[model samples]
Target: MEAEACKKCGYTEFKKGKLGNGYVNLMPINSFFSSGSPMIVTFCGHCGEVSSVSVEKPRKF
Candidate 1:
């Protein structure tokens, strides 16, 4: 995902982190190692401005 420009300050930057994909202990299921999707949260580190960002899914070959 690409970082977005802040509307309030016109700053372009992003902070990264995983969003979801929790492990559940169920029968015949070992989803404990699944990796959650990542999100690129964009915000102005200086001015504290923020904006929502949408990105395309990663392609696999």
Candidate 2:
């Protein structure tokens, strides 16, 4: 998904930030063992602002 506008600078263009991943920490002690999907981080090229959003839809607890 692409961001429509940057909240801070209203910039319409964004660049995909450094490759990032997502993980679930069901328990603090097992944080390292859990696995999940990748996360998308977008940066506003005009103002250096950034946004991190999960690519997957919300999940029920």
Candidate 3:
């Protein structure tokens, strides 16, 4: 969605970075964990605004 125009500044380009899988939280102190899929980092090259898109698709009704 924001790949074309930046949601912050309307830039037509972005920088993409890879994220990891073990993206879960193993902190026992917080007692929270995530066993979900991977994700991507998309940021506006011009305005430095960032957004995330998950590899998993949205659930259907």
RMSD to truth, every model: 7.7, 5.5, 6.1
Against the correct fold, how does model 1 do in TM-score? 0.32
Model 2 ranges with Cα > 4 A deviation: 1-3, 19-39, 53-61
Q: Candidates sorted by TM-score, descending order? A: 2, 3, 1
TM agreement with the true structure for every prediction: 0.32, 0.47, 0.44
C-alpha lDDT of candidate 3 relative to the true structure: 0.58
lDDT of each: 0.46, 0.58, 0.58
lDDT of 1 by residue, 1-61 (tens): 8766777876776554333333321112344443433444455666765555433223210
Worst 10 residues of 2 by lDDT: 20-29
Error of 1 at 48 (Å): 1.7
Candidate 1 deviant stretches above 4 angstroms: 1-5, 10-36, 55-61
Tens-place lDDT digits, model 2, residues 1-21: 875998998989888743433
Question: In model 3, how large is the Cα lDDT of residue 4?
Answer: 76
Of 1 and 2, the candidate ahead on TM-score is 2
